[model samples]
Structure formats: C-alpha cells, structure tokens
Target: MRGTAAADRQSRPGRRALVAADLSMLRGPVSGVVVLPNRLVWAPAPAGRFDLDDPFDRLRVYEIVLREAVHEAELRRWLNGAVLVEVWPHLYLPRGVRQAWEAIHPQLAVVPAR
Candidate 1:
C-alpha cells in the first residue's frame, strides 16, 4: 500500500538548489504545508512585515517552489518570475496551482442539511 502511494509521486524537473544570488522572501521555520496536484509546498513563517515584491527591504520571505518530476528541469522553467499567492500566512500557492489547490480545499462548502 505504501509503495503504491509512493509510486504516484513524480519528481520535479530542474535543479533543486536555490541560487545563492536569488533572494527569497518566504524563509525560516516551516509554518505550513500545502499539497497540490503533483507538487508539495513547504513554507516558513513571515519574519517581517514587508511583502514578497519588496523583499530587499527588511527581512525577506523565501519560498521554495518545486515541480513533481522524475527529471528536474531548469529552475527558471517553473519558478522564474512566477506569480505566487499566499493562501494563508506563510502558506503560498503558485498562480498556476491556485484553482487546483482551492478545489481540494475550498474556503466555503455546500453540504446537504444534516
């Protein structure tokens, strides 16, 4: 059973290393985890008051976005200048993954009268 589930996990394409130069805003102790269609995102608590766009000033929030692929593609392919949205504090989802993430975990639900 465990093996079957593991089989479904596809490694992302690209170098997993964070470029020493590229500054990241979402950093520090992992505050939350969100699961997407074929990816997993781990985020740390926001260390400062500044937003992602202006990470240069004050403390920065570093986010590590990964693709679920067996052969890693170039780091820029998926995450380069990619738009990101914060679902919850520290928890972020890439623009491309928003709908899919929301589908699995909707903010509002419609349930039959119980």
Candidate 2:
C-alpha cells in the first residue's frame, strides 16, 4: 500500500485507541489483539521454541515478526476487522529513548501491555 491508498487505509474511521489500562483488564495471558473503535478481539502469537537473550534484540525481532505477519495482503485481509495490539514492555523502549524514537517515527505510539 502506498500514497493515497495507504493514507486511506490508515485514515479509516474504524481505528480505535488501545491504552495501557485496557490491557490490564484482560483476564488471561494474551499476546495481542485486534482492535476497532468499540471492540477488542484477542489473537495470540505462537510461542517460540527458544527464549531470546538480549532485550533490545528481542524487541527488534518482535517488530520484525509483527511486520512480517501483518505486511502481506492475505494477512491484511485477515486483519480487516481490527488493528493489531502492539504490546508494551516488549515493543516499547525506555522513556527517553521512546521520545527520541517517536521524534524519528512520529506514527509510533506506546501503550501499556499489562
């Protein structure tokens, strides 16, 4: 997706805000969820066979994994009804670092992952 189409896709009115508090309210262990203006649908990621050692590297890997999962047209089609929940602590960097990251990538926002 690019230019007008990309903008249109992102600008769609169904977009919803998922705050940190909402994540805490979830009952069970959830990897993530698909979000809409008024609803949240949980969809967990599969567990890996091994654990990651480095924290920074882990976050980068998670971002890449999410991008890969969400980039394809078929996956996007599957995601049509909701927006992906970006888990905090993992996806979120430290406070000062996060501010700097946002300075470079304005579209990025951090929300609590409970």
Best by TM-score: 2
Give a tens-digit lDDT track for model 1, residues 4-111: 112222223222222212213323223222222223233333322333344332112333433232222322333322232232223332432333323432431222
Listed in order, each prediction's TM-score against the native is: 0.22, 0.24
The local lDDT score (0 to 100) that residue 110 gets in candidate 1 is: 28
Query: What is the C-alpha local distance difference test score of each model?
Result: 0.28, 0.30
Model 2 clash pairs are none
Clashes of 1: 15
Query: Which 10 consecutive residues of model 1 have the lowest summed lDDT?
Result: 1-10
Give the total clashing residue pairs for model 2.
0
lDDT of 2 by residue, 1-114 (tens): 310112222111442211111222223212233222111123334333212344444444333333323223322332211122443335633334334324433444554455
